[model samples]
Target: MAEYEAKFTELSGFVPEFVNTEEKKARRFQLATKSFISRNFSNKLNLNVVPLREVLQVEIANREIIPVNQVHHRCKLKLEGKAFEVDLIPFVLGKFNMVIEMDWLSSNGVQIDCKKKKVRIRVQDGKEIMFKGQRKTHKFLTMFQTKNLLKKGNESYLAYVMDTKKEIPDIQDIPVVNEFEDVFPKDLPGFPPDREI
Candidate 1:
């Protein structure tokens, strides 16, 4: 209880507000993650798909094509399946993003604000250190909310991500996706050096 209050105070100094006690209780189980230059998203099994992967396969010719707007589904993050609550829409972020999310929607909308130039978190008497990786969640918003980095004094680390629902591959256009055959590639091209997990 005391620890959270101290961290909350530290977070409030960097941002305009702090999450309410009830909100925190409601969201305690949801895990938050972010992509950094050192580490980005890695669901590479998405890049290449093999033929006849679906063992119980059936093909239909000339079925009704559903536009991206009319579709929504579930998705799960391979790294943290227990924490992901997904909702898919046939609309892109910048263009059109169509996909499903996992069953849990509790954690998807939270945001973390870590653009502070030099922030500090103080705990007990005579214990304070430069704080890093400080962020908060605003339930249901996309990564857009996270991109709004901090700007203080003459220093700022604000960087906007691409509205990546741009022209996506035809494969992703699939109206429905299943985790059955989807796997991240063990070895991916253009991968950076290993970082601590």
Candidate 2:
């Protein structure tokens, strides 16, 4: 393995200042969840198992930087009765960052809208599962399948995979607004059209 070194002829004082500011911005939020739950674990209802269905909608809360050697955006999640910590890591495809963006609606309420760019996390025997793209336009549909190559899983093969779109539909409906003709008198009579002097 070849080692490389960066040699700088001139070092600017502002370099440290700029780096400090960017670091602060990245580590703004911290995910905290253990404190909130006051219920006893012995109660069977409190330890209710969240149904690990093919797809589940979870409300995300407390958007904070997940400290994993480096700063990563993560959030507190609530799925049915269970509270979990989910890292906001997008599924990458080649050079594109096509992802399912999670947004916080209000007051620690984070919801995942699966209608656009669907994110499918298929569960197999409770532990093992695969994350897949459920939409046709998802760029990672093929890549996701290739990465998690399984002969047979609990999730149907045809359910998550989708065929690429053959052709883009032409723009059919476009909003057209008429120009205000009488806003200014159009070169009326002898008034030299309000010339900019």
Quick one: best TM-score, which candidate?
1
- 24, model 2: CA deviation in Å? 5.7
lDDT winner among the candidates? 1
* lDDT of model 2 at position 67: 25
Give all TM-scores, in the order shown.
0.19, 0.18
Q: Can you write out model 2's per-residue Cα lDDT over 36-146, one digit (the tens) per residue?
A: 121232132233323222332222323322222211233345434344454332211233422223332222343334555433332223432223356447455465675
Model 1 lDDT tens row, 1-197: 99998997888777643434555434322212111110012122232212221221111123222222121223343322233323322222322222222222213332223566444433334444453553566665455544443222344455788878887545345545424225444356676889999
TM-score, candidate number 1: 0.19
Distance (Å) between predicted and true CA of 123, model 2?
9.5
Clashing pairs in 2: 60-110
Error of 2 at 86 (Å): 7.7
Q: Tell me how far candidate 1 lies from the true structure as C-alpha RMSD in angstroms.
A: 29.0
